[model samples]
Target: MEVDHLFEIGDKIVYPMHGAGVIKAIEEKEIQGKTQQYFIMVFPVRKLQLMLPIAKMDDSGMRLVLNMTAIEKVMDMFRQGEIDRSLTYKQRYKINTDKMKTGKTQDGAEVIRDLMLVKKEKALNSNEKMMLREAMQFLISELELSNSMTEMQAADLLNDRLNVEKDAG
Candidate 1:
């Protein structure tokens, strides 16, 4: 969907690098002697605001939150531990970074899933650990809000799914 059609004030969106943010407003501004439109997003938890030029929204990879169907698919992948988990750290980092840069919710889900798996197997390096924590918190917050559940409940659901998968594998 086009960014303009997909986004509006009060809409919740996921920015790849920034996680979940709400659309605070859309406004016109004068930049470089031209009038331009921009989407203003507020990251409440982080206490930061991001402004993206409307003309560059798509290229910037701004995206809406996952729908119920997509959320379910992500949960299914988590439950089945479907992602390959044996890649080198550098390879894994590159892959997950690419996924995030694409602004695809499912890709974010995969990164969360894989990182959780890695965490289960062994301790992650500092950078990996930090990224995993950020991804998990982002996924949980968005899922909880979208699914109408508490964050703890959402996390419990993920843990239960991971436990089941660990048992099966």
Candidate 2:
């Protein structure tokens, strides 16, 4: 049975942790003798495919791509922020991980912003380094779809104004 859904084919959306992708199909497959509808999405840049069960979509932390205006606000967030050095690294990582799981562009930008600030002071541990890398890729992926930017263009945008010094000399 074909039914209309909130998202349709060709719609672009962000799947938390996997980045942005275009919905290619809504398919029903029989698994464990049960048939269920799934959204099949393709991440162009990464050449990755993901299947999201319709019943579980809301719980998956997936979201539609941000519009240009909201994306601009996210960029602003990346440009403004101070790290809380008081917390231990584990606590910080837990908070950042929670932010990433929100599937909100603003939270991802905040994670990136806080980590970049930490980087300016000292090196990030292996886990922090990996978190930073994943967050960066996710940001760039969403930015590309939001503004119709090439991956390179999106990356360049992220780098711009990122070298700000908190204290003016």
Candidate 3:
């Protein structure tokens, strides 16, 4: 399969479950006598470099970072009310994890928004707390890139916006 090489070096992209990164290089290597293309991505959040095979990129849920307009739309999602909290934690976990796997900004916002509501109500189990932390960090990192703001600035803005909604509710 000839995969689309849509990403260029220096392009910022998001790898689901891994957060956002920049494409540092594209390389082809032969393994088992088969040559394949790979995108070398540098994730600032984890300070890690990964080689993602181009052919599998689409299936991996890798995507470009949200543009400013799309970021604004995601911010709007935060202003909306929380999702249904009737489900047990296990059920909620599955739904939220599926949203995270989509690598879509709005879906990510949903995960963050729902989890934030849960945190407000009571203590989250360790798993839920870790998920909240990861989701928040991912949102902050993407906001930094899309808004051209520093990490601290992005984080503060995110909290301020969410807090406003929290206070209103």
Candidate 4:
């Protein structure tokens, strides 16, 4: 398997389990007398730091942000709003968690889709609601940064595609 250099120092990247983080530094260090390179990433929101070995980057499933075309596809799915809502919460949660673990941008988008479907059905539990908010925030921030749009504008675009009227009484 080829390992693509998907991140650079000072760049922001998203960890599937950790959400978004900035690459604080890249360093060569000796581990057990062997030289290894690592990307030091810090998650400001979680106050967490991760030292990811470069050799394991692909195994770790790290990836660059989705391109504009991919984002448009995800938005189309959101607009379609055709996800099955009959699945039990546990089943839905497992599916979303698996998607997150895959660390693919499309999987992340699927998480957003599932959460939005849950919300629209008024089927989200408290924990699920919190997870949904985090997932949406993470996805929106990356999309906004990648596409050079404001966070609010990005969110509004998604809402509009989903035909969700904000502040509708």
- The candidate that wins on TM-score is 2
Using all chains and alpha carbons, the TM-scores for the candidates as numbered come to: 0.80, 0.92, 0.91, 0.74
Clash pairs of candidate 2?
A: none
The best-first sequence of candidates by TM-score reads 2, 3, 1, 4
Q: Cα-based RMSD of the predictions, in order?
A: 3.4, 2.0, 2.0, 4.2
**Candidate 4's C-alpha lDDT?**
0.72
**How far off is residue 3 in model 2, in Å?**
2.7
How high is the CA lDDT of each candidate model?
Answer: 0.76, 0.84, 0.84, 0.72
Candidate 3 — which residues are off by over 4 angstroms?
Answer: 1-4
In the predicted model 4, the residue pairs found to clash are: none
Error of 2 at 40 (Å): 0.1
For residues 70-141, write the lDDT of model 3, one tens digit per residue. Answer: 887787777677657689989999998898888877788888888888888889899888888888888888
Candidate 3 total steric clashes: 0
Candidate 2's residue-wise lDDT over 1-169, tens digit each? 8676689998889998888889999999988898999999999778899888898987898788988788877677655667887999999999999998887888888888898889889999999999998888888898898889999998887776354433320
State candidate 1's TM-score.
Answer: 0.80
Candidates 3 and 4 compared by lDDT, better number:
3
